[model samples]
Target: MSRTILEVTDLRKDYRQRRGLVSMLTGQGRVIPAVDGVSFYLRENETVGLVGESGCGKTTIGRTVLRLTDASSGRIVFDGRDITTLSRAELRPLRREMQMIFQDLDAGLNPEMRVRDILREALTVHERPSDAEIAGRVRELLEQVSLKDSKLANFPSELSGGEKRRVGIARVLAVRPRLIVADEPTSALDISIQAQVVNLLRDLQKNLGLTYLFISHDLPVVELVSQKVAVMYLGRIVEMGLAERIAHQPRHPYTGILWSSLADKQTTEVTRRVTNVAVERERRTWGVFDFEQPTSGCRFAPRCPLYKEKGRPAICTDPASEPQLRDVGHGHVVACHFA
Candidate 1:
């Protein structure tokens, strides 16, 4: 059986801006919490999809997990090691096991570097391969991503968007990473091309036993590839469970609305008290979303149809509390007071 490859806990990142010299002196910079106390895991040959609205901090979670950027707080355990506090030197060697397939940032590659140079740069960082060896491996990696070595001589400007992404994939494969964090790999491409890229990733995963943290706002794509799905909103995961469970029978009001709209049931002509009760009850068995998204009660009451007014932010603004990710019957989980 595939074993767990990654574990995350209480991850939090906050960005603060200095208002002024006086504000800096007074320690009054405004704080924006991008990701707050989030936890999840991914296993070998397992794909976990994170879906949320833009600016909901889904991207922040992926980057922090890879240490592509520093995190403000949290523990990230990867490949049986806690990477949260690893030094840059320690992380450098671990690069062989961790890689990222970026969606947009790699698009503007230098027109000068051949495919060999780009792939070789990664090889040079961790291992010492002779020039001839690098050339041979470059050809091999490109072929794995379904590209030609001749295309290696070309620039990013010369390849189609899908092809460029394939090159990006090839670059990661060169390092032989065990866990690949694919962040929005298909968002900017046409639907037809998105399938190609995703399929390629899936095939690569099956062949290599790779673990994936697939982050995107695309719901259907998440459903297709992810064994489990985590739904984020305003910097917290509001709901989580099997992709099918979370997609078809969401318990969190926001998730319900999201899934409903996607399922073409958003009209609410007969607003459900909840319209998705059957879905919630099913999730009750699995008890997903057991913890409060916010330390407070409801993070989604403002948009929830089943919300009951209460006292304090801890009380009033707080979301539902019960329905831990207990096993309902199927492998499903949901979080919502009612669920």
Candidate 2:
């Protein structure tokens, strides 16, 4: 196996909500586990795709990895260093080794600054490079991301969506990060532009030898970019393994359901063959998830179709102990009783 660039172990990030007057008096409050015990590893030059529903904590995991948001518990080891509890001052010098590509290209860029200035700022912030070096680096970054020199003077708004996204990639490259936690990098663009950005990202990864934690709900995009795929639900990863296995022979019901929903003919047929279960009719909400942290057992049991089809079995709902990810074979692991 190649060197592990990023390893997240039992990572959890929770948000405590304030209570109203009546609720406060009654001692009622809620704790939402935005990222609950998500564990994964990204090897050097690898892209691990995190795919899930909108509120399934994909973005939270990305942010928590970079310490953009403080984690509630667990460890974040990057480049063999345990940085989970590193203070801001301690982490400052390490920042250059990691970066994030936001979903909103323009929002991440400074509207007031020109494209060249933005890239220059990234290079200047971490080290005292001379003006000549900064300028040369800026031009190199633009070329690396396939941007033209004319774009140097353009503000974020003046650029096309694809160009803005390229600029975002350039900014991250300016610091020469080893691992990038790209949270929906292509989410906001049209289909054509999405492919362009995806190709650009892939090319950069190949040439720069970058590792990526590519988080997105777009299954097709993830299929193209990732070597491994992790399917999360209610803040926990229910299924994860090699991308081809997850795509063609997903063991977890949630993973199967997601692939079945894809419109592509090839994808639909492959999912149908691997999972045997036909997509459920009357597509209502699968199950309800309460606001507070779940006590135990499989968090996805309530919404799982397999649970329902199996007559809501007690083993699934009240598992003897919380289901842990177990290897089925070929490095595929699933966290469900039936999987």
- Tens-digit lDDT track of model 1 for 128-177: 99988987888778777888667877777787888888888887888899
Worst 10 residues of 1 by lDDT: 283-292
Clashing pairs in model 2, backbone N/Cα/C closer than 3 A: none
Error of 1 at 7 (Å): 0.6
Assess the local accuracy of residue 117 in candidate 2 as a C-alpha lDDT between 0 and 100: 89
For candidate 1, what is the lDDT?
0.76
Q: Write the per-residue lDDT of candidate 2 for residues 1-339, one digit (tens) a residue.
A: 789989999999998867778468858776778888989999999999999988889999999999999999999999999999999999998899899999987866999999888988888888999999998998889889889999999999899989999998888888899999999999999889999899999999999999999999888789889999999988899899999889878888888878776743445555445434444441345444553545457776666777778887777757466678999999899988888
TM-score result, candidate 1: 0.82
